[model samples]
Target: MKAILPGSAADTDKPVVLGEAAEPEPAADEAVVAVEAYSVNRGETFQLDGGLERRWAGWRPGKDVAGTVIRAAADGTGPAAGTRVVAHPPAYGWAERVAVPTASLAELPDSLDAVTAAALPLAGITALRLLRAAGPLAGRRVLLTGASGGVGHYLTELAAASGAEITAVTATAERGARLLPLGAVELITSVDEAQGPYDVVFESVGGASLPAALAQLASGGQLVWFGQASREPVALNFFDFFKGPNQARITHFDYTTSDTTYGQDLTALVRLVAAGRLHPEIGSVRDWSRTADIITDLRGRNIRGNAVLTVG
Candidate 1:
């Protein structure tokens, strides 16, 4: 099989290169998926960068993938062989074939293509779980930051469908404009520009944005911190919480801890896509041979939404 590996540690550019991978040995509860397509994420690029002090010497970087099942789980826990599906592999999904746990794989509807299904795993699951954590969205004021990435696109649409009024924060006017059709009612350049007293806040751009978003929450409102895209630590004084919204709560969110499995959420997302309700904003698609260039585009923030690489 073929896969993507991080560039040489000495290389400052941190490019991803095509490489050979061992044939997958599926466990009793895992299926062997003949990967057709996979998506790139900003976090994976961050880990691929050699500048990071703690590097996994042979770590394979990939999370979301879609393909046909070549072999079903021996335990008969998931779909049978030949089923078309989207899967969240524990690792090494950037390959021609991958071993995916049954719990993390979902059969895709015939109406959904591999490219679109490939974009739904990580970002879509995270967005769905985040909304679940926030609870009841109907008639609520929901503020979302970093509202231009793949996760942002899904979160905006999902929250809006739940009847929540969404205020999306994006760095560029062009990027923000893309969210309007997805259901964001308001757009702003920064958290400082958001209208106050939001009922629920979905914040991902950490650093200064976290505190700013925190201050904007209404009393008893919930702020869910999901990512630190800015790569900066937050510094807050005790009095920062003493401001207007005294009872506001800031909760850290991680999708892995949620009660729902990846397959469960992926199934829901796939159904929505089949019914023309959810849209996967795939901004770029290229051959797997161009993985290096795709990583560069992701690192530079050039791709607007999800970037998919297909096996060829």
Candidate 2:
């Protein structure tokens, strides 16, 4: 089997190397999947940089995978061999084949192809969790920061489907416009212009945007913080935190530590995809051999929607 390994974090400009590794066998409760497609997440670069050193070992980097079940445990609790499925594993999904726990697999609907299913796991599950954390979105005023990114786009579509009024915040004019047709009722280039008092706020960009997002919450609003794309530290004033009319709650979703919760969220996401309520916007599709290029482009934030790599 072939996999990409991180050589040195110091050389961020250079691409990681692709090499051969032994193919893993399925455990008693696991399945070996012949990967057909996998998605490139923004966090892949951070993982390669040793940010997740405490959780994962080795350098194989990928989280979302869509494939066919090639081998299953003897108990047959997992999907049948040759069943199309997608999974969000805690680690090591960037290879020709991967061994994953049976519980992680979600059968891909016949209507959805491998590439699209590959694009759903991480981003879709994150969006589902955010929306659930915020409570019922029906007829509520919802504000989503970083609306142009993967999670943001899915959040926008899901919120809209629930009949929520959406105000999407993008960093650029073009990106803001790009989200309008994707269910964002209104688009703002900056958070300062957001018509506040929102019933719920989904904050994907941290740093200054965190505080700004908090300020827009309505009298009783909930805020879910998922991403730190801004690459800046968030600062909050104690007085504002205690005195704000709306009761604002901040929460972060780390999939590695919350597999049970993530699994449930993935199930809901698969249902949404199957029902045509959620569709991932794909930016680019690269071959599995071009793993380095995918990582490089993601680090630069040059790819759009969610990027996926097609494998055998």
Best-performing candidate as measured by TM-score: 1
Give the per-residue lDDT digits (tens) of candidate 1, residues 1-312. Answer: 678877775574647778887888888999999999999988887777743443455578889999999999999899999999999986789999999999998998888999999999999999999998999999999999999999999999999999999999999878878889989999999888888889998888889998899888888999999988777788776786776587888887888888889899889999998998899999999999888888888766788889999997
Clash count of each predicted structure: 0, 1
lDDT string for model 2 (96-158, tens) is: 888888887788778888898899888888777677677788999988888877888898988
Model 2 lowest lDDT segment of ten: 254-263
TM-score of each: 0.96, 0.92
Return the TM-score for candidate 1, rounded to 2 decimals: 0.96
Residue pairs of candidate 1 with colliding backbone atoms = none
